[model samples]
Target: MPREITVALVQMAPELANPEANLRKMGDFVEKICTEQRTDLIVFPELSYTGTELGLKATDLAERVPGHATNYLAKRANEFNSYVVFGLVIKEKVESILYNGVVCLGPEGDVVTDYRKV
Candidate 1:
């Protein structure tokens, strides 16, 4: 038998140029989905954390590959006992650029994986 997981996609509208509010919004949205829905995984839109039009500098919100965001998301994953995938701004030391990326968190409070957008 092939094992499968259910997924819920949240199409959220985030405020541009304001990552703090957006992150809070994302947290709230995630909480709502986990509480009210039935799914094994949740997928959020691109740049879900910071929004797409922030125009932020690399260092402004760039996070280490396994930094706070991953840890935070992982905690949620543990609490909800579900996998999550959300977009974020990640730092690249070589070019000092913040690459848009999506990180996946496992239920065990571990970074399951991350894909840096080109």
Candidate 2:
């Protein structure tokens, strides 16, 4: 029989006013999930990073598309050889504002898809 892939859903809260702390918190949660006895896919919260902070008038709260947040998530995913989905802030050089975004990572440590939420 083929092996079944187990999935893990991590639900947690992060400290306020500290990006580094939040990122590290999420990263650690992901690490623990992958380290469990068995797990294949790990899906995080929609606004995993930046606590899904969205600007009312501007997107500045978001991170640039394919920006640091995505890069960070990529590194974490690569380390565990598991798929992950998380949300974050996406900022664009074209504009000074940031927007909410999401990214999906494959077991190969490559980004499979990304999206910007308006």
Candidate 3:
């Protein structure tokens, strides 16, 4: 038999510039989905953590890899025993440098992949 995977795509309107609110909303979605069905992975839209059209505020809103946004989602992944993928603004170690990136968290709440948009 071929292997199978269950994936859920979440289309959400995240509050602009508010990572905390977005994370909470995403967490609710995750809980709701996982409660209702079996899911191996859940994916959110680009800029799901930070809304689009950021302009200069993007810099201020950018998060470090393994930062608040990822950590928050990772915990949810662990809670629901599912993989989660989402997009956010990432800040580099070098000050003021940032990238558009996607992070994937495993079921154990560990980061599996972090891909920066080219």
Report the C-alpha lDDT of model 3 over 2-58, residue by residue, as the tens digit. 989999999999999998899999999999999999999999999999998899999
The candidate that wins on TM-score is: 3
lDDT of 1: 0.79
The residue-by-residue lDDT of candidate 1 on 47-116, one tens digit each, is: 7877776664535767777887677778887788888888888887654767889999887778899999
Model 2, position 13, has a per-residue lDDT of 75
Error of 3 at 57 (Å): 0.3
Is candidate 1 or 2 superior in TM-score? 1
Q: Rank the candidates by lDDT, best first.
A: 3, 1, 2
What number of backbone clashes does candidate 2 have, counting pairs of residues 3 or more apart or in separate chains? 13
Judging by lDDT, tell me the better candidate of 1 and 3.
Answer: 3
**Cα-based lDDT for every prediction:** 0.79, 0.72, 0.94
Question: Which numbered prediction scores highest in lDDT against the true structure?
Answer: 3
Residue pairs in clash, model 3: none
What global local distance difference test value does model 3 have? Answer: 0.94
Give the runs in model 2 whose Cα sits over 4 Å from its true position: 1-3, 53-61, 96-98
TM-score for candidate 2? 0.78
